[model samples]
Target: MKTLDFWFDTVSPYAYLAFERLPQALEGISYSVRYRPLLFGALLKHWGQLGPAEFEPKRAWTLRQVHWQARELGVELALPAQHPFNPLALQRLALACGDVDGLPNRRVVEALFHHVWRGGGADASDPARLQALQAELRPALDPQGGEVKQRLRALTEEAIALGLFGVPTIAFEGKLFWGLDALPMLRAAMLGDAWFDGPWNEVARPQPGVRRR
Candidate 1:
């Protein structure tokens, strides 16, 4: 069976949106999904780029776009009080949930995404909240333990080595499909469809308000 590696951060609204829709969207597809939780802030720092929330215009547009996209997907979306909350413990909690192939673990990940994005629980960095979530998610494994912390760091490093620059990246057979917009393209690729041969060309049009030299 083919596997699709999905890297995501709980802090990313786009990731939340994608996660909510993927199970249903991929209903007919013959592929196994593997969710890899990683720290998006670390990736951003390594890439020397500012996140969408770093700029006012981008942040405003992103917030609006997420809501619009959620409506389009028929999924309810609510923004957290903090745009970019710390997701270290959350990532570790995801690891503690065990294999992504299991329904319980997948559900826990989905629940966490909903808690942050739809539930408006905000402040994932808070130890109390993280602990509560970890317990509620998977009490058997210790998310705050040293082993899980190391495992989370290792996963982040592995993602960096895999050329993952952003969350919600879908990888299969050494090819990567980035962002929610790329989901269709990834599906096409899986079906052996050449949907992205080249960029579309456009003809230039005359401007009515331009002054002649």
Candidate 2:
């Protein structure tokens, strides 16, 4: 079976969006999804960029687009109290959950995304918050916090070694599909379904009821 390398940081709005939609979106498929948890700062360091809000126009545009998608997805998203919540523990906890045998990693990841993105909760850094999240997610994960945290450190190091740059990245075979907008293309690639082949903006005037993707 084909596997998708699902990389995401909790702070990313797009990642937040994908977390809510991925499972059902890929139902009936033959692919396994693996979560690759990493720190956003590590990747941003490569581009010499700080957080998004500091970037003005880009942040403004992104907020607008994210809000639009949030409304479309019907998920409540408040402006986070701060940007770039410390992701170390969060990633570690996820790694622990991922390591659990027969545990639902995707479901827990979805819950983490919802908690972080929907409630403006700071999860990546807060152990209590992370503990609460794990409890609400799965009993098996809730009991393995220490081991999970230890494994998270290892995963972070692994992410650095993998040359990971960002979150919400979907990798299949050896190719990486970045962002939620790429989900359709990733789905297509897996199913041998090609919706677009040539120019993307060919339809200057689209039908009234038709939605792209």
What is the lDDT of every predicted structure here? 0.77, 0.68
Regions of model 2 farther than 4 Å from truth: 101-104, 120-131, 134-150, 160-163, 193-213
List the candidate 1 regions with Cα displacement exceeding 4 Å.
100-104, 120-128, 195-213
Q: After superposition, how far is residue 169 of candidate 2 from its true place, in Å?
A: 0.5
TM-score, candidate number 2: 0.71
Worst 10 residues of 2 by lDDT: 195-204
Writing each residue's lDDT as its tens digit, candidate 1 over 5-124 gives 888898898888888877676667788777888888888988888888779999999999988999999998888877776777677778777763321356778878877876664565
Best candidate (score: lDDT): 1
Residue 20 of model 2 has an lDDT of 72
TM-score of each: 0.84, 0.71
